[model samples]
Every structure is written in structure tokens, then in C-alpha cells.
Target chain A: MVKVVFTDHAGSEQSVEVATGVSIMEAAVSNGISGIDADCGGSCSCATCHVYVDKAWLGKLDAMNPDEDAMLGLSTDRQDNSRLSCQIRLRDELDGIAVTTPEFQF
Target chain B: MSDSIVNEEIDRRPESKWSMVGKDPYSMPLEKIDLAHPGIWQENEFLPFLKRLREEAPVHYCAESATGPYWSVTKYKDIMEVDTSPHIYSSEPTIGIVDAYEQFTIPSFISMDPPKHDEQRRVVQGVVAPTNLKALEGLIRQRAQTILDGLPIGEEFDWVERVSIELTTQMLATLFDFPFEDRHKLTYWSDVATAIPGGGIIDNNEQRWAAMEDCLATFTRLWNERINAEPGNDLISMLAHGEATKNMPPMEYLGNILLLIVGGNDTTRNSITGGVLALNQFPEEYDKLRSDHSLIPNMVSEIIRWQTPLAYMRRTAKVDTVLNGQQIKKGEKVIMWYASGNQDDEVIENPERMIVDRPNARQHLSFGFGLHRCMGNRLAEMQLRIVWEEIMQRFERIEVVGEPERIYSSFVKGYAKMNVVLHPKKAA
Candidate 1:
């Protein structure tokens, strides 16, 4: 299991142990972490799962694609580190990664 | 006697190059029922055949000249994968199943990527905040009951055509702030927009253009009205007043309203009729529902799962990515089947069977997930639950007397017409 911390737009913290294979959105939802609604079930269409990954690990993981960039822009209060949690898979290197939720999912 | 006419395969074009069920696995004759004709599509096809396709390839792929034979992503897990991965997959190319013309751009923020998508959705969301959604609830419920109240006292009517459509239209009218008298136009326009080939729900392009033009004109009127008036809480009002983001242009507002129509209209209508159908097929389950009303919420989720209303939401790949060991190139279409994913055995037990209290009800992909999840989901459930409650109190028995039909649409999947004979309840 990978240990990850999730921070919301308000900066609330949710520390949980995520399985290696699950996506960041899955980990947050199954654990009952608030903020990420994920209405489309992780489809790129719905921006409900918008998150801002802690910049510490931004360099280690893949960069946001055009779709991801576009979706983040759709989110409320998106930061430069904004990323769709569903796009970030949990790998060993991403174990300490943290993500902050957006102000709104609509 | 209730009759059901279902056909998994609607109209087949001989030149179709894709085959999803057979030999090449990637190519199969396009086999899908038009959902507009609820009577025949549900009765003769849809369900039973969806089961067969599941058995063959949990992840079936097909093409119908729209997206040039894209992946179906049929299995529950696979569909979820497609839905979950926004960066790797997208909604750009073929927003849904129907392949529109190159120049034809629908202001479907749902299908757009972020920056722009976010601002537009934000504008709408602002209008539908919890407070707004709550206020609309009582009114919507009342509207639903009023429509039900008007149904034939003791006759089995076509629930989809009568109850569901009327209920949804009234709710939409509130959202659009259109006068209640013009409610039918909303239904008519929405129906024409989602009308598929199998059900003949739509007329030719001229007819479609006329209806769309009318809708556009009405929206223009609304926008101008809002622009003139100060911003209020309503969606159109909020959008008119809200500052457009750098990406969301002011011109796209009218088109965005149309997107809201399709997003809200077809999805709820299908879910409503699908809920009734699920109850009809699972009599024992329905009985359970009749006895314990609390399960209405779960039942709503199950119906959305069973119906999987909006069929395949198309996403284009923004970059080359590997899924299930397959190499997907950039700009390729990845059609996610939320309906198929809701039934994945891995995620839900006996995915085919409708479990009223299925503990993990959120697993279904009906509302979608990720950044682009459905905005009207909460209201949808509220409407469905109230509809069922009224049915339980007012109906003794409702059975299909004539064959049901389905929408020919590859996108919105639902019953176009379902005839039923309702045994009205006598005074307690």
C-alpha cells in the first residue's frame, strides 16, 4: 500500500494508505475523503475529481496532458499544480504524494 | 397482456466495417437498438443481448462510420478505466457515440477539456448550488406528483411518454425559467436532439433545424432578458451575470444552454422509465420496494445502473497511452460504456441482478466520475424517488400491454414508448 495525503482547496488534510494500483480519485472516494465527487466515475468529461498535486512530486510523475490541463482550468480555484486525481496512479515513488481538492466540482 | 419487442440490432448498413461481437473482435456489424422506440427496443432487444455481448467480450469494440469503429470499453472495469483517466482519455473527438460533422461544434462543456470546460461548468454550477438545488426540490416533486395525478385513473399508460417526459420537462422549464405553458417545446426539442434512427423520433434535417432554431431563438431571448435584468440565482440568470473566464467566451452561452438541455433531459427520462422497467422485471424486488420505502434511494441508483441511461460518452486520447496492454495513439476515440461498467462482476456482485440495497451503490458509472461527473445527479435521484413513491401509493399494478420501443440513439439509451395498463388503486 502507498501512503498518500490529500489536501482540499481549504487545506484540510486526509492521510490514507492507498493500494499500489488504484488511482488517486479511487483512494480518496473509497476512504470517504470529502471534496472529490467524481460523478462521471473518473471519465475525463466530468471535472468533479479536480485536485492539485503537491509540487514536490510533480516532477517525478508525468505532466498534465491537454485534456487534464483543460479540465483543471474548468475547476474552481485551480493552482499551477492542478491535476485530475484519476489521472495519477499510485506508484512507489508517488507514495508520499499529496493532492488538494478544488473549491467546486461543477 | 403486456408484450415486449426487443431487438439488439436495429438498422444494419451492409457497408459497416466494424464488428464487435465476432471474428475480428474489433469489427462487427453495428448491432444496437434504437432507444427511442421504448416498446420494441426493451421488449425485443437491449437487455438480453447486452448479456450476450458481456459473455463474449466484456470489452466489446465497434464502429458505425461515426468514430470509425472505436473501442466500446464494454466491461465494467474497462469502462471505469476509460472514465477515470481524463488525461489519457478525453471527450473531444466524438463527444458521445453520434459522430457529428467536423464544423458542427456543440457547446458541450461536458465533452470539452478544462480551462474552458471548468469556467463554463462553474457558471452553471454556481446557479445550481446546494441552496438552489434544495429550493427546486419541493417544486420539482410537486410537479412530478401533479403529472402523476393527471395520468389515466386506472389505465396503464405509456409511462415514458406520459409521466417521465412531462415530469422532466416541467423541471427543465424551471431551470430554463421558461413559462410552464411552453414545457412541451422543451420535450419536443430534446427528443428531436436525441432522436436516433431505430425509433423514428426525429424528422429530416430541415425539421431538426427548425426545432433547434426555435430553441436557439428562445435561448437568445432568455439570454438577452437576463443580460438586461440583474443577475439572480437561476442558471441562466447567473450565467448572464457571471464573469466569463479567459477561456469561456460570451458567445458560447446560448449553445451551452442547449448542452444543459441534452445533459438534463435524456438522462433523467431514461432513468425514470428504466426504473419502472426494472421494477416490472423484478416483481419481487418491486414488492420489496413497495413495502420498504427507504430503499427508494438505492433503487434509484440501481435503476440508473440498470438503465445506464446515457450509453457511451466518447473521449479522445490527448496522448499516447497504454490501456490493458493495448497501445492507444493520441487523438483516438475511447468510448466508455458506463452501462457496461455498472455490471462488472469484479466491482459489483451478480452485476446483472438488481440488488436494492447494494451496499456500494456508488460504484455505478451512471453519473460518471472524474472532473466531468454529472451535475444534475442529485436532483435526478430526487425526482426518481418521488416518482416511485407516487407510483407505489397510486398504482396497484402496472403491466406492459403493448411492445416497448427504444431510442435509435447510440448516445442516450432509453425507452421512447412503453405502453402499460395500470390497475388503479381503490380508496383505502
Candidate 2:
């Protein structure tokens, strides 16, 4: 199992443990974490599951696919570290990765 | 104006069109069921036909209809697949079931493929983005209170006109920074944009073209005025200064303006009306809502699902592809029936009923999935949330007093007139 931490816009933090292969979105959703809508259910279509990965772990994640890049491009709050959580599958190396959720999902 | 006159008009029309209107969904051969007829939708008889399609043939083809030959995709998963895969199912030419006429065509991002779609959409999406909504919320709530407080308690009024149309039109005016007095023109142009010819709103294509011309002229004046001024926060100013859209041709500017106007207008207007009618239809759900006002946000999503305001979005097959074992030829029209997909029992439990706290209610397809998903979705949700919140504080119930009148098009599944009476909240 790997540990994932989610910090909401209000600065509340939630940590959850889940087996590898599940996406960070599924992890946050299953743990009843607020701020992650995941409206498209991980299709990378809806940008609702957006997150800002903690700067340290940003290099460890998979490269953003063109679809994810295009989707994030439409977000007004998008930052350099922004990523759609559904695109990031949990892996052994991603253990203890922390991210923050925006106040509202567009 | 009356049912008999409308029926006589349909009867007098050529039999070749609207042949499927009065036919039974089950008794008729499966191949004979045509879902595009505006008659079934306006009459609220489209559900049975959609159910039959989902049960028997999820990706059935209609060989004949008023529009032409087209494929109906009725399942939830299949819709997700087609919506996400824009390369296979292109949105170009036009998204409407009817083919586009060269003179009337307006170039908006909703019907365009990516690169260009991505560029133009980026320029204006921020106007309704969630951050901007936070600033607009207090104003929206203020407006809702004004509209609701003025309502006549215990007396009949058209909810569509009094509450739904009025609030949404006012909101659109604020979004565009449009002239407050002429805001009614925004609502009229939006209706005409999606109206079907020979339907109640318009008599023929020429009338629609004239209305479009007037809309274009009015907006052109707004654009010229805003383009030379300091950039403001409104949509017109944003478009006037937007890098991707600033140099666009007159028709494209009008197209994008009409897109925002209609997108911002008709959709939420109907949902506002639909929520009142749906709550009355399911009294138990209303009781649950009255007891716990905390459910407003979740209920907003459930309302959108139950309403599914815009019925379906048309996508043309970019290449010869097989979807759910049915081979769709290149350039054929494929209609994604979101109205059917929302009720597909496979994804939603008790798909027919309106459960206020229904789990994952936001997952519904009212805002079609993928690249072309409704950009103003967050704004729509915010408007509904504020309206309902203010409503609960003032009214015990907004009762649907009489039968609701529906719009004439199948594409826009919404109400035209719904008589309602408001019951004031009793003191604690």
C-alpha cells in the first residue's frame, strides 16, 4: 500500500492508504476527501479532479498526456504544477506524495 | 395557442415528416422508431421510445426521419467513449441534427475541432470560471432575493416567465455587461437561435435569419464600443481584447456571442423551472429537502440530472467506425442521447426518480463529456444553488399549480410556461 495526502484549499489535510494501481482521484474519493469532484470519473475529459502537486514530488510523476495538457489549459486557476489526479496512477514511488485541491472545481 | 390548433397543424403537414409522433414505441417495429421528431419531446412522450432503444438496440439507426438517416447512441458507457474520442466522432460541419446552411452558419468553438477549438475556448472560458463565480455569487444571491421576494404568494404566475426566465436573463445581462433595459433581446435571440421553424417561436427560416441579423447588429455595436476602451471584466471586453479571438471575422464574433448568450441563457432557465416541477412531482423528495436545507448543493446536481435540459448533442463520424457492434460510415450523423444515457439504470440507481441526496449525482451527462463539455457549467450550478438557498429561506414551497407548457424543439428539453404558486414559510 502507498500513502497519499490531500490538502484542500482551506488548508485541511487528509491522508489515505491504498494499494498500487488506483489513481489518486479514486484514492481521494474512496477516503471521502472533499474538494475533488472527479466528475468525469477519471476519463481525463473533465478537469474537475485537478490538483497542485507538492513541488518536491512533481518530478516523480508521469508526463502529462496531450489530453490532460489540453484539459488543464482551459482552467483559469491552472499553475505550473497543476495536474489532473485521475491521470496519476498510484505507484510504489509515489508513496507519501502530497497535493492540494482548489476551492472549486470548474 | 391551444392543443387542438397545434394538432390540426401537425395533421395538415406532409405525412412524410413527423410520422413517428403519435405511434406507439413498443408496438411499432424497433427499426421504425425515430427519436428526432420534435412532437414526442415537446409532448413528453420521448421517454418510452428512448427506453425501448436502450433495451433492444443501444446503438440503433433510424432509416428515415424529418432530419435524415442517423444513428442513436443510447447507452452511458458508449456515450462516454464517443464523447472522449473526438478524433473518431468529429463535431465539425455542425452539431445540429439538421445540416447547416452556408449563409446562416456561425463559427463557434462548440462545433469546432481542436487546436482552433482549444485556442478560442481558452480566451473566454475564464469569464464564467469558478474564481470569477465567487465574485458574482453575492450579486446573484441579491438578484434571486429581489425576484423571489416580489412573487405573489398563493396566486398563480408563470414560473417560467416570473422566476426562471427573469432570473436567467438578468444574469446573462450582468455577464455580458449588456444594457439593462434591452436585456429582453438577449432572451429572444437565444430562443430564436435554437428555435425550430414552424414552431411557436418562429414561422420560417427567413424570420430566424432576420432575427439573427438584428442580434449581430446589436452585438457589433457592443463590440465596437468595448474594443477601444480599457479592458473590463465582462465577456464583451474579454472577447474584444482576447488574443485568440480579437481578430475574428464579424460572423465568427457573432457566432461566439450567440454561443455564450444561448449557452448562458436557455440551459439554466429551463433547469430553474424544471427543479420546481420535479420537486412537486416527487413530494417525498421535497419533504426531505424542506427538513434539511443542507442538501441544496447536492440537490442542484440531482435537479440538473432530472432535467437534462438539452436532450442530445449530435456528432458526425469522422471516419468509418464501429460503435457497439454497429458500423457507422464516414460522415454519418451520430446523436448522443444524453436524455437516455442519464436514465440508463446501469450507471444510476433508481434512474427515473429524483433523490435529493442521490450518490454521485454530478456524474450525469447533461453537460456532455469531453472537449465540448458546457463551459458555463460552474456558473449554472452557482446560480441554481443561490436561488434554492434563498428560496428555502423565504418560501415553504413553490407549488406547480397547473400543467406546464413545453418548448417545441427536441434539442432543448425545457418548459415554456409553468403556472406556480408560492407558499410562504411559516414562523418557527
Candidate 3:
């Protein structure tokens, strides 16, 4: 299992032990964590799963694919650390990685 | 499967494609792809043809079709591009490839562009808002339990009518605060609103028009009643009191009514039926589900993804645009095949199989995207979750006794009749 923390826009934090191979979005949804609607599932389509990875662990994740990059580009609150949670699969090295969800995901 | 609800004669025309069912769809040239014909879907043979289009020509154009020429956006990324880019690919003119029966075009916000669309949609958005959804959850679960408990055990019955349509129509009735006793009328009006002329319940344009008129008259009566009543939580009351919706013209009112009914009905209804059929088809998956009931919510998303209830949503090109290297001219109809996109191998790990616990199961394009994304989406998901939860508690297995009778229209990928025999779980 991979341990991950999700911080919603309201600043509430949820730490979940997600099964390995599951994306961070899956962990949030299974735990019923709010702030990430992930409307399009994890197809890297709907940016509802947008999240800002904690700067400390940003370098550990894979580079954003063009599709995820383009979708995040459409987000109004996108930041340099912005990454769609659906695109971020949980891994051992990222055991304590934290990500913050935007206030609203259109 | 028995004969479809729609008459077979309607598909016997010389130009109809029903006769080509046995032919290998993959062998056909990409240019020959026409996803509009309902016959192909009624026969349950649309998958391979769409797969071919999605693989060989993701943005292929069909110059000749029952609904006239249009572009098919088959891949997941391209579909996202078109569905999200509402300005470049207009939803106006109509979301269905074929224009609304020329004589009966009621303009709804789903087919309108922004500003106007956003203003009108806000009126009823509260009905499915998070707070409203929280309040509705208990009511939905109770109704689901009642509906599931009432079904006969070990008897073959049409799941579509008995379970799917019944629950959704009941939800629609609750949303509208419509008369409980007259809830069946909601189903009838919704069917008539979507059925093609000379197909199924509607046999002619006159019959279709009369049904619309009746729908208008009935809703107008409700509108007048709510217009004077104290503000309530129902959709009618919301519209009656909303600044942007209060003075909508007769046709626009009818348009919004159809939008809510079809939106609230088909997606959940079909997913309910499809989930059962899918579980039966992949028995191992059924075992996986039976072994772990915790997967119910995830299974609901998987079911919606697999069903892709509304096969496609048509958009008109607002201006010349280059899509996936294909040139699209202004005023051209572009069909975004959500069903095809959901199964695109490039995105979905195993696009063909049914896996209840797919990690990113919610990533399907079934509800569409952009400003016109389904407003009742969360509500739809909640209802499915409740129904399946209630089903699992009562029955060990829902045995498919006969082939399912699919809805005749390619537009609404659903079943009209699905025979199932319930096997209740023995008490411990």
C-alpha cells in the first residue's frame, strides 16, 4: 500500500493508505475525500481531478503527459506544481506525498 | 432476444443498414462509417464498426448518412478536445445529429451556447447541488429498497421496466414534485420526446406533435399552479420563481422539460439494466463483486462507463477548425462518440472488459464535458449506487433468462426489455 495525503481547498487533510498501482484520485474517491470531483474518472480528460503536488515531492513524479498538461492549462487556478491527480499513480518513493485540490474544478 | 420495441419494418427499407449486421464491420472502408443508423445498434453490432473508426480513422468523416454528413471524433483525447471546446464545436442547432423533427424544435439550454445556457441552467442547478443531494440520499435509498423488495423472487421479468425505468421515473417524479399517482406519465412523455417518428410509441409526426402539445399543456398547468404558490424545492417551483426561467416561451419551457426528463431518465435507466447484463456476461466479475461488496460505488462508475448510455452527442462546428489533422469546415455536424471514446485503448487499460474495481473508473466520457456537462450527474451516480446496494442485499444473483431487447435508437443506448430471474440470497 502507498500512503498519501490530500489537502482540500478548505485545508482539511485526509491521509489514506491506497493500494499500490491506484492513482491518488482513486484514493481520494474511495476514501470519500472531497474537493476533487474527478468527473471524467481517471482518463486524463476532465480536469476536475486537478491537484497541486506538494513542492517537496514534485520532482519524484513523472513528467506530465501532453493530454494532462493541456487539461491543466484550461484550469483557472493552475500553478507550476499543478498536476491532475488521475495522472499521478501512487508509488513507494512517493509514500508521504501530499497534494492540494483546487477550490473549484470546472 | 425478442423483436425490438420499434417495428422491424422501419428497418427493412432498401437504404437501411440492418441487413449488413452479419458482415464484418472491420472489413468495411472507414469512409463508409455511419454511426447515426439506429438499426445497427438495435442489433447490438455497433461496437466493432466504432472500434474500426476509432482505430483506423479517429476523426473520419461520413459524407452520407441517415442524418446527413458529419465528422466522427472517436478517440478519447479528440473527443475531449471537441466536447470541451464548446466554442469551436458548437452544441447549438441540436445535440442530436439529426435535427429535431423539423416541425418540432423546442430550444433547450443543452443546445444553446454560453451566457444564455449558463443563465437558464442555474435555475435548476440547486436541485442537484451538494446540499440538496445530501438531503435526497436517504429518500433515494428508501425508494430503492422499496422497489427492490417489491420484485418477485425467481420469476422471469423485464428488468428494464420493473427496475430501471421504474426507479428513474420515480426519481424524476420526486424532482418535479409531480403527482405520485401520475408518475407513469413522466415515462410516457420522456419516451415520446425521444422516440423517432414511425418508431416505437410514435407512428407519425402528428402523433409526436400531439404528445408534445399534451406535455406542454400539462406542464403549463403545473407552471401556473407553481407560479402563485410559495417558493418550494421542486424544479417547477424553481423555474417558476427563477428570474431567468420565469418568463421562458412555451417551446423553451417544453425544451427544458424534455432536457430534465431525458437527462434524468436514460443514463441511469440504461446503466441499471446494463450492469446486470454485464455482471451476467462476465461471471468471474460477478464473483469478484459477490466476494467484495465494498466495490459497489466503484462498480457504479464502471457500469456507467461500460453502458455509455447516450451513444453520442452531436456538435456543430462554429468555424473552420483543424482536429486530429482533419479539416473541419464551419456549420458541419461533428458527432462525439462517447461510447467509442470510453473504450479507446490508448486511455483505458482494458477498454473491452468489465472490471468493477478499475482504479480510475470514473474517467469515462459518458456524462460528456464542457458547459453542457450533465447537471444531474452526481444525482444519477447516487441513485445507481443506492439501487445496486439494495440489490446486493436482497439477491444473490439476477439470472439473465433471455436475451435483452435493446432500445432501437442509436442515440439512447439502452434496453427496452431485459428478462431476469432473481435468486435471493438464503438467510444465514
Candidate 4:
């Protein structure tokens, strides 16, 4: 299981362990994470599944792609660490990843 | 109507990154886009991609010129979180997908924050509100029935053009209190503004740009004329005196008016076409629906879920944040794949299959979520529902004589020209 931390739109943080093969959006929704809304099932279409990658862990994760970049342009509160949770896949390297949720998304 | 391109000719398997025509974001392969032909999603690489994302990376990453590098969020529950929150992610920069921020101006309320967005939306909200729509239901039904009367049984026609565009455009004209004769212009302007996906159907960047600018100037002229004229019941009049809009300069208002044409056009057109196609695709569901019209609402939601008119919308990051285990920097863009979200296995059971009675169908992110949900959603639904109802009563079946064509752009998923053969109950 990968330990993931999420911060809600209200700036609340919750950490949980997600399975390695599962998407972060699934982990959050199944474990009751309040902020990550992956409205589109990882199609690189909708920007609802938004989250901020912890500053320290940015390098560990895979780089962002063009489709994600285009969709991310639609969000309400985008940040430096802001990433769509659906885009990031779970793995051992990201096992202890800590992320923050923005205060708002659209 | 069947789109023209034959699916059998393409690779039957899901398009792998390596197998894809172009691996990198910078070099866009136009060949991969079957502009003249529609792709069969049921058997295409797109559906499997959604399934894989659901089981694998609910939130996936994508790199492109618009946001450089960004994440794509998939899965139902996660999308809800984004939809519900508006303060964090934003759409103030642009609305059309695929295009960079420089290509388009700041969108209207469709991409704005609460206070400012709600202020502008209020003008039309009263006019297009569900309650107001209910008041216009009889009129809409009458008009719809009249249009249905014109369909030729077993003869081919472009449903996308005849039914979807004309009906919705007429309705939009009503909301704008526009002159009935000028309704076609609204559709034209919308098509131009929405050409952000590879610069529209013609693929001519310069021509589309010049045309759109000209159309925009005309809209500005008209908005000014209407606003300065009598206080009519249309959106233009409302905006002229509206609390949120009265103070704004003419350019912003012009931008918003142009925004309206796009906001109204692409979405409603795709919905109707999508609905009819969905019903045709599932003959059993169509039979069930035709036999029992009560399933129209659920079917409408399912159509919205299935079609997802505005394919993908974007949002920018405000600060440093982490998604899943990925590191994200400040001011980065994140794209949400609503199409994939709708098919998330974790959220909707057998999401790939369109179950008419799917309880969570409303959970789809087609109209978007949170602060920027499509303001014209009610109007869209009303029009679609009415269209399907009329179809159910008027036609025997909507046959697919030609292979349907898909939109060329990555942002919007729809048919530009779908040639369909309609078999009606009787000749009009």
C-alpha cells in the first residue's frame, strides 16, 4: 500500500494508504478523501481531479503531459504543485507521497 | 446518422502510446484525427483508455503547450471534489480545450469564480432557470413537434444540422431576444469561437481567425445597439442593465456575448446528436425507451454522460500541491478528463456500457462541476429531453447509413457532419 496525504479545499489534511496499482482518485474516493474529484475517469479531458504535489516530492513523480496541461487550464484555484490526482499512478517510489488539495476547483 | 469513416480500417486494439502516430505533444499528428469520419468509441482505443485509467491511474499526467505539463483526473468521486471546489482551480484564462491561453480571451461565467461569475450568470439564470424553462415547456414542445413534422421517413439527412443545431439555435435566439431571421448567425459565430480544437472543421487557422474576429465585431455592434435600445426580455437587455454587467466596458460584454454563442452551440448540438446515437447504438435500450417514454430523464442524463459535449475543461494551480504521489509546482495547469471520469469502474459499474437506469448517471462530469458548471445546463437538458421525446413519438428509428465522423479537436468530442437516414412514422 502507498501512503498518500490529501489536503481538502478547506485546508484540512488526511492521509491514507492506497494500493499500488490503483489511481489516486480511486484511493481518495474509496477512503473518503474530501477534495479530489476525478469527474472524468482519467481521460485527460476534465480537470476536476485536482491536487497539489508536495513541494518535496515533485521530482519523484512522472512528468505531466500535454492533455493534462490543457485540461488543467480549466480549474479555479491552480497552484505550483497543483496536479490532477487521476494522472498520477501509484507505485512504490511514491509510497509515502504527501499532497495538498486546493480550496476550490471547477 | 452514420459517420463516414469505417472503424474496421483502423487499429482494433486500444491505441498504445508507442503505437500512436505521434509520441510527443509538440508534434501533433493530423492523420490520427479522422475529421471526415466518426470513431466507434465502443470498439476504439478511447474506451479502453478510460477503463485503464480507472483501474490504474485515476489521476493521470499529460504534457502539452497549453499547460506545459499537467495532470488528468479520472474517477467519479474525485471529480466531485473538484466540481464542488471553485476557489482552488480556475478557468479565467480560457475555456476551449487544446488551445493555449493566448489563443482565446478569458471566458464568461462558464470559467469564472463565484462572486464575479454568479453576478454575470444571474442575468440569464432568471431567464434560463429551470422554473422559467418549465414555463416555456409547452412552447418548446410545440416547436419541437413542428420540426419533427418535417423529417422524411427512411431518407437520409443531417440530424446534426436539421434538428440539433436549428432547434437549439432557435431557442438561444429566444433567450437573447434576437431577431428570428438572424438566428443562423449565432450558430456561425459559435462554430468559429469553438474551433480552438485544431482551428475548427476547415483546418484553416487564418480564415477562421479572420471570420471569428469579424463575427465578434458584429456581435459587439449588436450588443451595443440592443443594450442602448429598449429594455427587452432577452439576455442582452438584461445584461445591459444587470447589476454585474452594467458597469463593465463594451469589450467584456462583447466577449461574454461571443462566449454565449459557443456556450450554447457546441454543447447542445453534441447532446442531441449524442442522445440519438446512444439510443441507436443500444437497440434494446432504444426499444425500451420507445416503448416507455418515462425513462427519458434517465436517458437524458445517460446521454449527457455518454456524449460529454464539452470534452475537457482546464484549471490552473495557484500554489504548490501534490496529487497522488506526483510533485506539482505553482501556477501549473491540470486537465480533468470528464469522459474518462464517467467511465470510471470504481464509481459506476460497467461504466463502459450505457445502462439507462444507472443510478449515478447524474454523477457524470459532462456539464462540469463546482463553480463553473455549465450555466446553460438547464436549457441544454430541456432541449435534449424535448428532442428525444419528439423523436420517440415521431420516428420509427434513426438508422445509421453512413459512418459518423468525430470532431478533429482533442477538447470537444462530437460529430461535425453526421449523415443519418431517418425512418419516420409517416412522411411529413
Provide per-model DockQ scores: 0.26, 0.83, 0.15, 0.05
- lDDT per residue for candidate 2 within B309-368, as digits (tens), equals 989988999999999999999999999999999999999999889899999999999998
lDDT for predicted candidate 1 compared with the true structure: 0.68
TM-score of 4: 0.70
Encode model 2's per-residue lDDT on A53-101: one tens digit a residue: 9999999998999999988987889999999999999999999999999
Q: Residue B95 deviation, candidate 2, in Å?
A: 1.0
For every model in order, the TM-score on chain A comes to 0.89, 0.98, 0.96, 0.90
In CAPRI terms, model 2 is classed as high
Candidate 1 wrong stretches, greater than 4 Å: A1-106, B1-67, B100-104, B197-199, B245-251, B425-428
lDDT of 4 by residue, A38-72 (tens): 64555555565788888899998788986566456
lDDT of 1 by residue, B201-255 (tens): 5434455556777887887787789778877666777677777632345436545
Error of 4 at A1 (Å): 39
Evaluated against the true structure, the overall lDDT of model 3 is 0.83
Which one is best on lDDT? 2
Best by DockQ: 2
Candidate achieving higher TM-score, 3 or 4: 3
Point out the worst 10-residue segment of candidate 4 chain B by lDDT. Answer: B1-10
Model 2 alpha-carbon drift over 4 Å, by segment: B1-16, B102-104
Give the winner by lDDT: 1 or 3: 3
> Is 1 or 4 the stronger prediction by DockQ?
1
